[model samples]
Target chain A: MRATGDTWPHMAGAAAQPVRRATVATLPAVKMLRRALVALSLAGTIAGLLRMRGKGGVPPQEGGWREVGVPPQ
Target chain B: MTTPIVGLAGCGVTGSRVLHHLAAHQVRVAVYDPSPALARNTRVVRLESAADLMACDLVVLCGPAPHAPLTEMLVADATPVVSVGDDLDDMQALLALQPLAERHGVAAVVGAGMAPGLSGLLARYLAAQLHTLDELHVAVHGTAGPQCARQHHAALGDAALGWHDGEWIQPPGGSGRDLVWFPEPIGAHDCYRAALPDPLLLQRGFPTAQRISARVSATRRDRLTARLPMLTPPHAAGDLGSVRVEARGAGPHGERVSVIAGVAGPTAELAAVVCAATVGQLLRHPVAPGVHALGDEALAGLDLLHHATQLGVRVQEFTGVARATSW
Candidate 1:
C-alpha cells in the first residue's frame, strides 16, 4: 500500500517504527479499573434487559444544538 | 452563470433529508431512487433510471456504500459528483478515482457526510488556528438510519486504521477505549477505535500531521458483541448524534495548544445539511478536478461551516473556564 505514492504522501526519509506492546504489569491499576467498569456495565445490561421484557423499545430522544462558543479564528 | 440543477441518487434516511434541505434552499433537483415511495415530492423531478441523473450539472450521492462505480460514471460523463458514503473500504475506492476525476476535469467530493464530512471540516478549521498541527483525534457518537447502524456494527468488529508519524497502523477494533465528551444532551460516552475512514480522508488533507485517529462511541456490550450478529434490531432512526474533533498543535507563540470543537444533532439531519452545503459551495465556486475531502486546504472550511450553519447545523467549540486572578 505504501508503494502507491499517489494515495499516501511520500515519507521522505522517515522509517517506520515497530509498535511496542506494554505488559499488564505496566498499568495494573488501569486494567483493574477497566475490569470493574466492565463488571458494572454487565450488571446494568442485565437489569436493563429484565426491565425491557414485554416493553416496546425505548423511544428515540429529541435534542437541539446549543453553541457554546465560536470556533477559533 | 445560471443555477445548476443538482442530481440526487438515493432517497433513504439521509438522502431524503438531503432532498428536504435542497428543496428548502430552492434548488432544482433531479432524483432517481430504486424505491418509488422514497422520492414522491412534487418539487424534485423524478427520473426513471439512475443514469439519467448524469444530465444534471452535478450529482450528490447519499446512497449506501460502494458508490465508486456511480461516481466514476458521473465523472466520466463530465458531471461533478459528491458522495456521503462513510464506509472505509468504499471511501478508499472513491478516493482512488482521483486521477480519473482529474483527467476528466470533474471534481468528486468523497465522504461528505457527518464524521468524515463535518469532522474533517472542523479539523481544518482548528488547524487553521494553530501555528503547527501535530495530532488530530476524532470521536463519533451515534448513527442515523438502520443502514448507518448496521455499518456501525460492522465497523466495530473490523480492523481499525490509524496514521502515526507517517506510517499506517492497523489495530484490532473494539480496543483502545477513551472517554469523550460531546455537547449537551449527549454528554460523555466511551469511544473505541473502529474501521472509520476519517484517518484516511484526513491524512490526505493533513499529510504532515504526526498522528491521526478516529473512534466511535459504543457501550461495553457493543464491543463485547461486535464480532457477532446484533442481538437486537437497530433503531429505524437513531436519536441525537455528535462528533468531536480535537486538534493538538502549537499556538502562534510556539506554546502548546489544544482545540476541541464539535457539533451535535440528528445524524441524518447533520449529514443532509453538510451535503446540501457542499453542493451549494460547488455550485458557486467549483473545486479543482479530483477527489477532495471537506477539510482539504483547497476547500474553504470556514466557508463550508458558514454554509452549514445557514442550513441549521450548529457548531460548538469548547472553551475552558478562565482562571481567577485571585481566589
Candidate 2:
C-alpha cells in the first residue's frame, strides 16, 4: 500500500537503512520488561473476561455522546 | 450491527494504514487508485474508476492536493466524504466544499486525521467545557529519525498562517518560538509557529476564539534541518509523536480555565486510527447531510470521543490549570 503523501510534505532522497530486528540478546533488560508487560496485560484481560461471565457483559450505553460528555457547556 | 460500505481513494502510506484499520473492524471497503497494486489487500475490493467508488456510503480522499476537483465531484454525487492531511489547509479551498455538500444533502468532513482531525475535536470539546471560550493553541511534536527531513523542512521552513484576535496572520515558518510541555515520552520542546490546519479548523468551529496558533517541533536534529537547507536530514530517532491542544476560557464559576488533551504514538498510525474512527461514525449515519469540520457540532453528532477511546488512543484531559503559569 502506498503511504499517504500530498497531505503533508514527502520525505524524499533521505538515505535508506535496513532496520535490525530487536533480539533478547541485543537488549536483554528491555526484552524482559516487554515480556512482563505482555504477561500482565494478558492476565488482566482474562481476569476481566472471567469477571464479566455472568453479568451478560457490560451494559450498553444509555446514550452515545452523553457517556462522552460531548459539546455543551 | 451492519457494516457500511467504505471507499478509499488513495493507497499511500496513510491510506494503506487506514485500509488496515477499516478491515480490522470488518467493514466492507472498496479502494480506488491509479495503481490497483497499491490496494492489493486480499480483503478489500479494488476498483479502477471513481464511478465505482462514488456510490459508497462514505468516501475517504487520501489522494494528493488539488482535492477541489474530486471532492466537489463527490459532493455533487451526494456522497459524504473526508480527506486526511493538508489538502484543505487553505481555508478558502475547504470552505469551497461546504456549499456543495449542503446543496447535495451530504456530509463532508475535511482534515479528519491526526493533528487537524483529533486536535480540532479536542479544541471544540474543550470549548464545550467552558462558559466563554477565548483562545486555542495546538502544538504537535514528531520525532522521527532523519528519514523525514523533507517533511520537516516543508513543515517548519514554509510560511505559517495563524489566527489572532479575529484576523488571520502569516508568520515565517519556524519564526515564533514557544517552550511547550507535552505528555510523557515527549516532554517539553521548543516549538515554533508553523502553518498547520488545526488552528484554522478550530477557529471555524469556535469563532469566538480570539487567538489560534498551531506550532510543530521535533528532535533537535530535525528542527535544525527544517531551518537550514544545507544540512542533511538526520537518521531516525526513536519513533515517538505527540500532539497537545490547549484551550483557555472562563468556567461556570467565573474562574480562568485551561483544558488540554494530548495523544502520543506513531504519527501515521495515529492518523489512521482517527480516520478509521471517523469512518465508523459516518457508517452509523449520525452525521447530518452537510459539510462540517471534524470538531464542529454537526460532525460531533457522532461520538468522536467515544470512537477514539475505543481505538486505544489515550486521551488525557487537564482542567483548572492556569495557562500562563503551566506552559
Give the least accurate 10-residue stretch of model 1 chain B, judged by summed lDDT: B318-327
Taking the tens digit of each residue's C-alpha lDDT, what string does model 1 give over B1-327?
A: 777799999888898898888888888888888886755666668888988988999999987787999998999999999899999999888989989998999899988989889999889878978899999999999898888888999999999999988899999899988877788768878899999999999998998799999999999889999999889998777668999998998888898888888999999999989989999889888888899999898786437877887778888887762121120
- Model 2, B263-297: lDDT tens digits are 77777667778899998877776577666778787
TM-score, per-candidate, Cα-based: 0.79, 0.73
The best candidate in terms of lDDT: 1
Worst 10 residues of 2 chain B by lDDT: B318-327
Q: Model 2, A1-73: lDDT tens per residue?
A: 5544433333432223345676646478888999999999999999889877655544222211111333322
**Top-DockQ candidate index:** 1
Candidate 2, number of clashes: 13
The models' CA-based lDDT, in order, is 0.86, 0.72
In terms of lDDT, model 1 sits at 0.86
Model 1, C-alpha of B57: deviation from truth (Å) = 0.9
Name model 2 segments beyond 4 Å from true: A1-73, B1-3, B35-40, B87-91, B143-152, B219-238, B318-327
Two-chain DockQ for each candidate model: 0.08, 0.02
